[model samples]
Target chain A: MIELCKVTAAYQEQSILENCSLQVSSGEHIALMGASGVGKTTFLKLIAGILPPISGTVHVSAERISYLFQEPRLLPWLTAAENVNLVLSDSEKTIDEAHHWLEVVGLAGAMGKYPDALSGGMRQRVSLARALAYGGDLFLMDEPMAALDDTLISQLLSLLHQYTQGKTMIFVTHSLEQAKIISDKIYLIKNKTLELL
Target chain B: MNRRWLKQVLAMLFWLGLWWGMAVAVQRPILLPSPAAVFLRLTDFIGQPDFWVIVSSSIWHIMLGILCAVILGSILAVLTAQFPLLDLMLSPLLTTVKSTPVASFILLVLVWIGRDSVPSIISGLMVLPVVWSNISTGIRNVDAQLIEMAALYRLRPYVMLRRLYFPSVMPYFLSALKISIGIGWKAGIAAEVLTVPANTIGKMIYESKLYLETTDLFAWTLVVVCISLFIEKIIIAALGRLDIQHGRKVAASDD
Candidate 1:
């Protein structure tokens, strides 16, 4: 469940989101579509409690949150599996869990490989694996499938659909097809406010 | 064997030959002892029981100083990075410490602590500023995006440290250790030479100089160099093992 009543977010003098309001019930998957520099990432950040609203209020009623950033943001020092394991608890089981997620993301062979050794798509999948391994009720993803091809994106989307069942999600993307596939409702950012389509 | 190894061996032999020629020309053992004489003196030292004791004692004192400096420097770096006021206050003091001569610190510490403790304290003082500056910069330079991801996941404090902070700061920490170890060890020995602590290599060097035993002085100085190199190799080996175990193969694959 999420709620935002007239949330005005800004970075110093530059306003990203102005007096924007939105509400989503539990288990709702919402897609946010916006042009470049249009604050789609800012909206996700606001919901994930990364950025504070300059003037209004935002609330997210979730026990845990998993965020997939635009960039992979994987720890370069950690191997692909180790990067996923970073979000998991320290246990033998967690190692297996990390491996499982990496496998699900089609990175079974790359489990021992470092981020630097992996391609851009592979790295992004590793980041996705990490987010999925975290196992959160609320998922905030910013263009998570941007690096993958259409076939891979479809496969991953199906996997995501199964994993995120009954979980609340706020996905940001430019692809209308992806927006339709992953989200129950679609909202576009226009003129500094969320416009439902 | 290989080209590089052959080149290195040749270079070493060339230096040794030049040193032998100079000693033969001088023929004054008091001013500059022959290489063979110094080597024989070192062999005699190696056979003595007192040599190991002296070597171990110096190692203990300098290592203790280095360890203390590492711990305290890391803590201070974290604290200063967290609090701007603390950073403002510590900036000038650390800069002063960095710029101050090793002999100055030795003298100042001599007035406060006993002769035996002077080496440890002086070495710690010598190392602290470098460790602090490097680690503070590392902390400040951690990738912001990774930090945001860590926060979003609500990672435990210790987990965050082990996973995020440690890896991010490791290169800087290792660089600080490499630089500061040499500086600290040299400074510690200098302190010992001044203080003339009992049963130390520094004390033996001083006594050798006082008695005009040039061969003994050269032998003791060689011991110092050998030990410094040995310690550095051991540390680098240990850190390399840690890096391997942690899967930090970035440096190797960086090229």
Candidate 2:
């Protein structure tokens, strides 16, 4: 289980989360829904350990945490396969493992292609493959499929559902339908506090 | 490669024809050696044992000096990017170096260093400002969002450099390298000529000029041009290889 106790995080003087508290258990998918710029991404960042709270405690039982950024931050110089390979260990075995993940993400044919040659949906899939291949127990995603078309987004969501069956995911999105599709629990941000529903 | 080769060959032939026409019109070897005369002189120089020594020595010094300058300039750029105070402190000195005439520096270096080392020193000095400015610009222009992404991922320092910084700075760095190498060659040779460094191409050119050996001077000039072009080709090829080895294909996902 992961728990946030009295999490108070702010940017400069602008307080984004104030005394925000939440709990997530293993095998649970939580959707954090809030309007744009209402600190949803900030909350995910804090949970990812990318940002430390001003005064709070976060406890995680997961061995590893992998974050899928809102933007697909693939290195431009690498082919899709090589980009995934970079995050893997240098040995041939680890590389083959990374390539397997690319295939799992439905990027098998596109592995040797550069990101520029891939569609937006394809790029996101590569990013998704990278995060998942890291073998993290907990996945923190900030709008991972926001750029995809409706059909592509649905396909990816279904893939996520199958692949992340036993993993814990704390994903932020403004799409209520997407939250309903993937999340077992929903945390909606209103004003400055999270309202668990 | 074929397209480029054809283009370059055509351009060279056109220029060579122009030079030949000008030489014919002037009809004075002292003023301008004909293309044929220069070719003959080039063959004569090739037969001399000292010719290879002079060319190789100058290449050695210039290459070493430029390499050192590039390394130092890149390190300095990284430091300055991290600390603004260091940049402010060094800006005046770098600007002075950039603004100063190459001739003045050549003369000063001749007095300060031995004649043999002058060309290398001059090459290093000429390359520094060009590299520093370009690298600093590259550092400053790195995508802010990528840095944020690196922060979000908690990327290690070396990982950040490999994934974020190197790809961003590469184009600017390559361009700076191109510009710096050309300038370094000219400045290094000029320094050598003025200093008359023994067993150096610049010294050979100086000797030819002293004896009014216009054909010899032209031959040496052609040798310098060929070497410079060769170096440029090698550097560009290396840069291309780096792009491939480093795997810097631009991602479609960039905002």
Candidate 3:
């Protein structure tokens, strides 16, 4: 379960998400939809605790949170497999787990390849694999599927439905079809506020 | 086949041809030695035990100075990057060292320190600022998003330094090292010449200059160039190997 009570986050003096409140029970999938520059990404950053809200109380049942940024943000110097391995904690099991995740994301054969060699969709899949590899209770994705084609997006959505239904996920995206496909609940976010749609 | 080696050979031949022509125009071995004269002098010097002693001594001091500079400069760079106030305080000192003439430093060190220590001190001082500035920039310019990811993941300090900071800094550090080693060799040799240290390459060059042994001077200069080039190649090759090793480790970890 996660709750953002009267959150007010801003950059400099300008507010992006102002006095916004949201709550998601455990195992709930919520999609936050909004137009461009409407704080959709900002909200995820706040929830992920990367940015502190100026005025708010965020309560999370779980301490660990996995966030997938809009960009893959994979280290260019690291191979795709290494990027996935970076998140795992267990030394003895990390390699096996990384391999498992890579296979899960259909990147099994390209483990030795660097990020530059991979296509956009493949890089995003690697990022998704990294996030999933972390195995956090609350998953926060900030428009992770924005770069993929419709076919890849549908495949990713289906994968998301299989792996994340039993876990709490707050997905922020602009695609209404995607929201309808995977989200148990969709919130029409606008003007630094959310209206349940 | 690599064109790089061919280009280098051609360039060397062109310069040698020009030098030969200039020597011919001068028409006096005492004034300027031809390529053949320098080569013969080089062969004679190579056969002398004393020449080897001088070359080895100068190389030892220069290499030691470079080692000291690399260690201290890298440490200082890391410290200053962590503390802005320290960086601010140290910036002027680095600038002063950088701006001060090599001859000035060599002369000053001669008066204040032993003749043997002057070249080493001068060489170390010459390399310090180059290393500091380059490494500092490298640290500052590390990918912010990767750092954020590391922070978010709670990566251990050792892992973060090894995996992130070192790789990011390697390229900058190598560039600085190449520049510093080249400059340090020149400054170190110059210091030796000025100080006239016994059993050193600079002393040989000084003796040759004083006696108008132009061929010997050219030969010693060739030796210095050869040594510097050799060291630079070794350093670059070692850095390349390290890069490959780092890449392999990262990949292996993923598997």
Off by over 4 Å in 1: B1-8, B25-27, B250-255
lDDT of 2 by residue, A88-183 (tens): 653456777778989988888887788888888788889899887776789898899888888878888998888788999988888989999999
- Among residues 3 or more apart in sequence or in different chains, the pairs in candidate 1 whose N, CA or C atoms overlap within 3 Å are none
Candidate 2, residues B1-255, lDDT tens digits: the string is: 999999999999999999999999999999899999999989988999988898999999998889999999999988988899999998899989989999999999878777788888999998998899999999999988667655644567787788678988988899989898899999999998999978998998899999999998999999998999899889988996896567664554244
Q: Which lDDT tens digits does candidate 1 get at residues B59-174?
A: 99998999999999999999999999999999999999999888888888888877999999988988999999999999999999888888888779998888788878888988
Best by TM-score: 3
* Stretches > 4 Å off in candidate 2: A1-19, A52-63, A150-152, B1-4, B139-168, B248-255
lDDT of 3 by residue, A1-197 (tens): 88999999986667998788888999999999999887887787787777899998877786667788888988777777778887785244587889899898888998878887788889999999988888878888889998899888988899888888689999888889998988889997777788899
Q: How far is candidate 1 from the true structure (C-alpha RMSD, Å)?
A: 2.6
Worst 10-residue lDDT window, candidate 3 chain B: B246-255
Better of 1 and 3 by DockQ: 1
Best by lDDT: 1
List the candidate 3 regions with Cα displacement exceeding 4 Å: A89-93, B248-255
